[model samples]
Target chain A: AQSVTQPDIHITVSEGASLELRCNYSYGATPYLFWYVQSPGQGLQLLLKYFSGDTLVQGIKGFEAEFKRSQSSFNLRKPSVHWSDAAEYFCAVVFNQAGTALIFGKGTTLSVSS
Target chain B: DARVTQTPRHKVTEMGQEVTMRCQPILGHNTVFWYRQTMMQGLELLAYFRNRAPLDDSGMPKDRFSAEMPDATLATLKIQPSEPRDSAVYFCASGPGRTNGETQYFGPGTRLLVL
Candidate 1:
């Protein structure tokens, strides 16, 4: 079975500041990782995904995540966050087997302040 | 841009009532998925379909929950005698293919509240 852990439950950052949200996963083989964001009362939107290739993957709204196999982590990061970037972010991992489902973390709520 | 669409953006019903949520996937996507989101559970995949065939539904409660894709564009999740515990935001997602790794586009979701 695969599982995901997000260490931070809530984080607050000032506008234009750098931000990083930690995510760790437990899976047997190379895992397919993803980061998603959700606003209040809205469905989740995919921020980024990592299947293979480059360790650092860029995503929409100035978001990016790095896949660190050694650390079993796919932490989401942004160099400078805007006020509109505040939302709940979830990290998920998919098992490589057929007919597999994605296992998600508890999610981290980001609060951006000016 | 193509996107997934879900019906009944909000549903409020008493316990023991039948609740049905509908989803229309992207025109060319081959895989559709149903997920439930709650404060405690986050986002959990309740069921998945590929090529209009049920692939996995282990996350779904077998007794009261059922999911089906009668055709390529349509997917439905029905709950008979829905309980208060079943109240959550249900999301429908669609992906391009059945590969292990694919980015899924999600619908706005149906918020179900069972009183």
Candidate 2:
């Protein structure tokens, strides 16, 4: 079974500082990776996704992720952190060969300090 | 805005009661998914459908849980004799289906509490 690992349970960053959330997945084949953000009492919002090619994908709210096949990682990064970006972020993988269901990580909570 | 919508944003039920949660997928979306989120289980896929037909529901507890799409726009996840362990936020998502890199748009979850 394919699973996602988000090493950081919670991360605190000063406003305007750079932020990075690490994610690693265990999959035997080429992995389909994604990042999503959820605010309190809100639905999960797509941040970005990586299927193939380019290796780098840009997403909404100035977020981006790099897919490293060798490292088995797709880490979400933002050059500057905004207070609004403080939310729970999830990393997910699609293992469609087995089933079309998505497997998600435990999630990393981001806190921005002013 | 062509987004998924879930009804009864909040539901409180007693144990052993029947609970039904509903979802309206984005128009034109061919794939719909049901997911449950809790503090212990971050997010789990319970079931999914394509073109109003169930494709996979392996994540669901078959004995107590049932999922169905009565029509193209509606999907339902029902729990019979609900338990406290079932307390969680149930989410519905929709996608284009059968393609790589397809994004799933999630609805505001229905928060359920089984007391």
RMSD of each: 1.2, 1.1
Runs of candidate 2 with Cα error greater than 4 angstroms are A97-99
| Best model number under DockQ | 1
lDDT by residue for model 1 (B1-115), tens:
8889999999999999999999999999999999999887888999998898888898999999999998998999999989999999999999989576787889999999999
**List-wise, what DockQ does each model earn?**
0.70, 0.69
lDDT of candidate 1 over A9-86, digit per residue (tens) = 999999999999999988878788999999998888999999899999999999999999999999999999999999
Per-model interface RMSD values are 1.6, 1.9
Give lDDT per model, in order: 0.91, 0.92
**Residue-by-residue lDDT tens digits, candidate 2, A1-114:** 668999999999999999999999988887778999999999999999988899999999999999998999999999999999999999998877545568899999999999
Q: What is candidate 1's CAPRI-style docking category based on DockQ?
A: medium
Model 2, residue B17: C-alpha shift (Å): 1.1
Candidate 1 chain A worst ten-residue window by lDDT:
A94-103
Could you tell me how far off, in angstroms, the CA of residue A4 lies in candidate 2 after the best superposition?
A: 0.5
- What is candidate 2's CAPRI-style docking category based on DockQ? medium
